[model samples]
Target: MTQTLTGSATVDEVMAALAALEDPKARAINESHGDDHGVNLGKLRAVAKQLKTQQELSRELWKTGDTAARLVALLICRPKAFESAELDAMLREARVPKVHDWFVNYVVRKSPHAEELRRGWFADPDPVVASAGWALTSERVTKNPEGLDLPGLLDTIEAEMKDAPDRLQWAMNNCLAQIGITHHELRARAIGIGERLEVLKDYPTPPNCTSPFAPIWITEIVRRQQEA
Candidate 1:
C-alpha cells in the first residue's frame, strides 16, 4: 500500500514517496518526449492532493530539480507568489517538456506578469521558450485578442512552423487552430493556411479523437460548437 503524503512531510519524504511511485513504463513514455519522470500523472496528483498547498515545500521540491518533484511543486504552487524574474528563471530551468508545459499552463498564466513574460518569450530564439510564448498567445487568441496582431501571428506561423522543433511546431499549430476556431472572420484564411502548410496532416490520431491537422481540427471544433 502507498503511504499518504502530508503537508508537513519533509522534501526527503516526498522524494522517497515519488521514488516508490515510479513506473518503468511511465518513465519510458516520458523519456520519449524529452521528460524523465516515472510517476503517473494521476498518482502524482494524488500525492499533491495529500500535500495540499505548501509554498515552502514546493520550493524545496523545485530545488531538487527532479522532474517528478518539480511537477509536484507546480501542482502545489501559488501562481501569483512567484516574482517575474523567479518565474523566468524557473521557465529556463524547466527544460523538460512536461515540466515546461505544466509550469506554463499551471503557474505562469496566472502570474501578474504573464503578458510581459509572454511578449518577451514569444520572440526568444530558443524553441522551448518560444513554445511557452506561443502557448500564452494561443490563450489570448481565444479569450482576449483585442490588441494581438492576428495577421502577424499567421504570417509568422506560415513562415516558421514547418522548420520549427517538434514542441515549438506543436505550439504554433495549436495557436493556428485556435485562431481558425474562434475567429469567424479569419476562419477561411486560417483553414487555407493550415491546408497549405499541411502540418500534422499525417499525424496518427486514434479513433474518435480529433486530428491535430489544423483544418480538420478547426472545422470539427466549430461544428461541435454550432451543434451545442
Candidate 2:
C-alpha cells in the first residue's frame, strides 16, 4: 500500500520525519517531492498561510541549516498563496541557498508575476541568486521566447558562466536547449553552446550511464537548430 501524508501533520512533524533520514541528500530529494502525491494548489495555499502565523517556527527552521528543513520551507511557501512581493520577502529572509533555489525553481517559475520578481534580482550581489534569475528567465524563454528580455538574459548568462555552480550550469544548458527547440531563430546559438558543452573538461558524466539528460538535451537543441 502507498503511504499518505496527512495535512493535519504540523510542518515541524513532517520535518522531523525528513530529518530522521540518514542520507542528507536523500532527505533533500524526498522533501523536494512534496509537490508530488496529491499536493495541489488549494492544499499548498493553506499550508503557506499557516506558515505565515508561525514566524518563530520558520526562523528556527531557517537557522537549523538543514537542507531538508529548508526544502520544506520552500514547499510551504507556494506561489499561488503569496503575492510576488511576499515571496520575494520570504526568499530574502531565507538563509539557505538550496531553499532559495527550490523557491526559484518551483514557486517563481509558476508566478504570473515572474517578470516583476526577475527585476528584483538585478542588483543582488550574490552570484547564486543572480544565476538563479538567469536560470529562471531561461526557463521562461523556453515557454515563450518572444516574451523574454533576450539581451538581458544573454548578459546574465555571460556574466554567470564565469563561476557558476555545476547544477546552475546544467540548468542553463537545459534552458538554452529548450529555448532553441521552441524558437527557430536561436538555432545557431544553441548549436554553438552545445559544441562547447561537449568539449568542456568537467562536463558531468553520470556513472555507468551512456546517454544522460544533459548531452541528450543539448543534442536535441543542436539538431533542431540545424533543422530550422
Candidate 3:
C-alpha cells in the first residue's frame, strides 16, 4: 500500500494510512460478523481521529476497503452524494448481514434516495435487499414515523415473515417489534405474530437482557422509552 498521506489526500492514500493501523484482535472480532475477508483497523473512533475530513473518500473505500475500512467508510460517506443506483450496487456487493446492516443504518437511511430505495428493495427478489428494506423501515418507525404505512407494514410481517430468508427474518421481526412498541393500534397484532413466530425465542441473550421476540422486545422498549 502507498504510504504517503496528507489532509487533502485521495481515498487511496487515506486507505493506506488506515491499513497501517490494523489490529489482529479487532480483525478477529470483525470476522465473527461472518465476512471471510473481514479486517479490523481498530476502533472507529480511532479511524475518525485520523481521517476526520475524508467523507468524500468513502465512495472509493466502499468499493475497495476491507471490512473495518468499509465500516469507517460508511461513517465518513456523504449520504447525499450517493445515488440510489450506487446504493443498490453496494447492497449487491455486501456479503454478510453485518455489512448489510451498516449500509442500511449508516448510508441508506441518510441518502436523498432513501424512500425510493426502500420501496424498490422491499419488492426485490434478493433477500438481502429485502431485509435492508425492512431494516430501514424499522429504523424509521423508531425515529420519525410520520408517513410510513403502519397497516401495510404489519400486513407484510403477517404474510411473509415466517418464510423470509435467514438474514431477512431478523429484520422482518424487528419491524414487528417496532410496530408493537410505537403503534398502540397494532400492538395486539404484533404480539400475536411474535407469539406465533417465536423468532429468536430459543436464542441466547446476555444476562438481564430481554428477548428480541416482538412481544417481549416491544414491551421492554416501550417501558424504557416511557421511563426516558
TM-score of 1: 0.97
Estimate the TM-score of every prediction: 0.97, 0.61, 0.85
Q: Quick one: ranking by lDDT, best first?
A: 1, 3, 2
Considering lDDT, which of the candidate structures 1 and 2 is the better prediction for this target? 1
TM-score of 3: 0.85
Judge candidate 1 against the unseen true structure and give its global Cα lDDT, from 0 to 1. 0.94
Give the distance in Å from residue 116's predicted Cα in candidate 3 to where it truly belongs.
Answer: 1.1
Model 3, range 114-204, lDDT digits (tens) per residue?
A: 8888888887898888888888888789887999888888888888888888788888998899889988888888999888877777868
User: What lDDT does the true structure give each of the candidates?
Assistant: 0.94, 0.55, 0.77
Identify the leading candidate in terms of lDDT.
1
**Root-mean-square deviation (CA) per prediction:** 1.1, 7.0, 2.8
**Candidate 1 regions off by >4 Å?**
none
Q: What tens-digit string does per-residue lDDT give for candidate 1 at 1-228?
A: 167777689998999999999999999988988889888989999999999998889999999989999999999989999999999999989998889989999999999999999999998998889999999999999999999999999999999998899999999999999999999998998999999999999999999999999999999999999999
Reference-based lDDT, residue 135, model 2: 64
